[model samples]
Target chain A: MMEQVRVVLDHAGDISPISSEEYLRIGGYQGLKKALEATETIIDTIKASGLRGRGGAGFPTGLKLSFTANTQADQKYIVCNADEGEPGTHKDRIIMVEIPHRLFEGMAIAAVAVGASQGYIYLRAEYPYVATILEQALADARRQGLIGSNIMGSGVDFDIQLFIGAGSYVCGEETALLDSMEGKRGEPRFKPPFPGVQGLWGRPTIINNVETLSNLPAIMVKGPKWFRSMGTERCPGTKLFTLCGNIAHPGVYEFPVGTTIRTLFEEVGGGCPRGKKLMAVQTGGASGNIIPASLLDTPMDIDACAEAGATFGAGDLMFMDEDSCLLDVLENLTEFFEEESCGKCTPCREGNTQLLRLIREFRNGTAQEGDLNLLLELSNVMRGGCLCGLGQSSPNPILSVLRFYPDLFVENSYRKGDLAYA
Target chain B: MTTREEQLCVLEEVAAIAAKWRDRPDMLIPVLHEVQTIAGNCIPKEVAMTVAREMRIPLAQIYSAATFYSFFSLEKRGKVLIRLCRTAPCHVKGTKETLSAFEQALGIKAGETTPDGLFTLEICECIGACDVSPAALVDDTVYGHLTPDKVRELVASLQETEGSR
Candidate 1:
């Protein structure tokens, strides 16, 4: 296996996250300087790097920039999606805390590439501490002439400010984030007039994930070929996986894109606390599908994981042992989705509650075998009929369990006594 | 209970905050955040009305936006807000036991505040501290690797801090 690659986490522990001087000393703004020298070719360099978004959706970063650049507008905006609410995903928090200036620099480069003048970091409210660190980092950069009017004397004016989410998980969706920034009930808008065409006060906008933007500076400095050489051909460069749950070690680790479930779990995660036997592994967070031990050899590539009935979303790898009951876990996840569904659409608002009720009945030992079919039908409806990603992906956990551990649902259905599992 | 004069003062404060973003009508969330923070963790009805009037938006819109978010509580919260992680990662690591310990120490359940109004225990999604499973947030400070005893000790420390004040 490849050694732990630090492409995304290069400056995490070496220097204080808020220290502008420390970040600059380690060649922090080199990429932004390079981009400033030749602003027009920056998009081409990014396109050549083959960097997809580090967010759950692996869209090409260069293609997104080109759309906004091509659009004609009196004003435009660049939004950094820092609302990392996906359960089991915390790598963005690590990036925001350890190397915040990297994010600022990346945003600056993106502004220059897309010809945008202003930017915003849409931070999640849960991370108030990280917000302060980021605010301090922005203050330090502004003081040093790294941000604000005519940065680095490159004659390009760009400014960025932080906007906090109001405890809405749906706000992590790009349009929903835009709505939340506009001070409305965080709900997703219709597509086609996508954010690239009309966003953030009806101006052309480009929304990039925090980790995705964090890569821009480095990709510029090391060159695209150097980045392409690190990971698999399809998904280039190292991906940060937040490894946690029922393991010997639980923290964020950066691994190559094609690392197998076995290596990520057994080798790096220390293999499911002693003698427990890794029963299951959940990837991509609550919205991601499951990878049973039978499929432990499946690669973490997006297409490969999709073929295995799972998604490589945000690289949230969670391990579970024999002692943990999948039924209880499903109930916990279902309840979370129901509470966070935003109630804008019928499918997500109603379907999530129905799913939670069904799972609770099963856990209470009063469920009928027919309820399983009902649960399946409802999940399909939500997946197809929901308006946004939150509703569409909310049923992923149940569907993954149904795909992998069918017997767990079968054995629990219509059972009488001795249902004392927690 | 706050006096009529105090309520009017809060409305004035809300109006003042709303004036900064009146031209930028899209800045509704930040404006409510400031009002809630100033109004002791809950968005008072009077303050919401002032914000709506100043922003030229409907009161219903303000209420809908405020109540839509879990972070913006419509009811009054205690001095310290305790957000416990209830995600699967923390659940498997014995979060139920830790939660029970907190419930016992606080003399109330997870969604309720203590009788003295010093603490409010809430079950939240992962706060991104899964590395230390059974992690919790006490007013923005994260405490991880918690045990039942540790929870009691934490409550005692908070109680002591409150007593000295």
Candidate 2:
């Protein structure tokens, strides 16, 4: 019985999320106060806590802040990636509705740590509701001397503004997010001039996930060792997982990083509604790999999930029942990739379209046996040649499903032209 | 209102929006958002042209930015835009049934507006509410864990609100 170790979600349901007074009653901004006392060691303290970015890519939070800190820029910016567009991942909205001040506090502290004066929260436009909540919370924080100049009389002048995304999933990518923030067509820029080097108006920027930012209050308040004790060595701290789909309890749940998928499905998620046997699980979003029931014992850590052939992207564990068809799931994922390709790179744009066509052909029983090999080759090409993570990781669902369930694809391949080829 | 008068009003609002973000080329999205917010439902051609002129951005760039995101609509939409989640999780858990319910209730298919111009139905991708499978967005309000019956009730409630108005 692994009880949920609530860290990021500490104040989620306990108080009125918009009220700064309620947040202060529960020890909010204490971390920022403590952080301002020794601003010099804030990044080092985060590094010592072993806090990794809760965003898809598990970059070290400390290292990202330090990069922006070291860069000699007159105007630096910190961005909180709230474009929660990844399918099956919705935990950030809970944070937005439950504890928006935590997000503001985290950004304010990051601003102090990295010497940034301005910050932006790039939120998804679909969640216009949460945007209102965040606005209210920002006002509440500002009124209480938490957001504006000389915050709590600490002489740190950091202000944050909310920017709603126009609805591109590619903007969830760090560089693409910066591009979207700049009012450009959201497209991924080439790396080496990473966001930390020359991001957001060609100034050094530190972009972190919404959940990643929310962790700072807890980590800063409690010492590094307290934060490190809960989760595994590499990925310390509890993770917020949006556990949904065909489960008795389909909601946000916080668990230590090393919790097994089996435990999550069986205990927390209640093992599929009405005791239906678990067929498959899509760990992470549509871009995440489809994990078979046999791999349920794998730890939910970033490295462990990668070893199990699924990157723990944004902590979305979508469980499916035995009655659900894998072909239908793959079709949905492929169509999503096709629609969200951004049309920037040829491999992703064309590869995702071709992949969707092949999946549809297979589903319609009009495929050849060679299409599987074609899908594999195309997946490899998209993975290698795509410009951004959107195109690069678009083929993950198809590849992972094919790896785990080859028979499903082969059985579905028996069509009108397949017998002629056979 | 006359078409020319409506166009003039849209231009006036667009100018105000552009002036707010003046000299900040990066604030185009927010400006476009505000323009749409003021204009309601869609960014008119006249408004977009005015934005282009005021912000010194090209018309092609403005159109591309508007068309890029699903939220920014160039064409007119109904007063209440209904975004239904048709992704895998929602699909498996009766999203098609919910869609059918909306179609039956509204007498229009997905992506089509009702004859009265009160509601528009559009299928959106997963909105991160898969936990509450079969979710929908009724003009920024998320309704999750829905069945066909709930969909009908939702439609009825909206109709009631519209009737009262």
Best-performing candidate as measured by lDDT: 1
Chain A TM-scores, candidates in order: 0.96, 0.97
Task: Write the residue-wise lDDT of candidate 2 on A104-169 in tens digits.
Answer: 989988999989989999999888889899999898888889998889998888888999988778
What are the lDDT figures for the candidates, one per model?
A: 0.88, 0.87
TM-score of each: 0.96, 0.97
lDDT, model 1, position A257: 86
Per-residue alpha-carbon lDDT of candidate 1 for residues B1-165, written as tens digits (9 for 90 to 100) = 268888778778889999887756678888888988778788878788888888888889899899999888888888789999998889889899999999999899998988777799999887878888889999989999999999999989989998788
- Candidate 1: where are CA atoms >4 Å away? A1-3, A417-422
Residue by residue across A1-422, what tens digits does model 1's lDDT show?
33688988896888998888999999999999999999999999999999999999999999999999999999999999999988888999999999999999999999999899999999999999999999999999988888898898888899889999878889999999999888788999989798998999899999999999999999999999999997778888889988888888888888888788888887888887876898888888888887688888988877788988878999888888988788898998888899889888999999999999988888777776478789899999999999999989888999899888777776775355533332
Indicate the residue-level lDDT of B57 in model 1: 84
Off by over 4 Å in 2: A415-417, A420-422, B1-3
DockQ of predictions, in order shown = 0.81, 0.77
Cα displacement (Å) at residue A39, model 2:
1.1
Model 1: DockQ vs. true structure: 0.81
The clash numbers for all candidates, in the given order, read 2, 0
Question: What's the lDDT for residue A96 in model 1?
Answer: 94
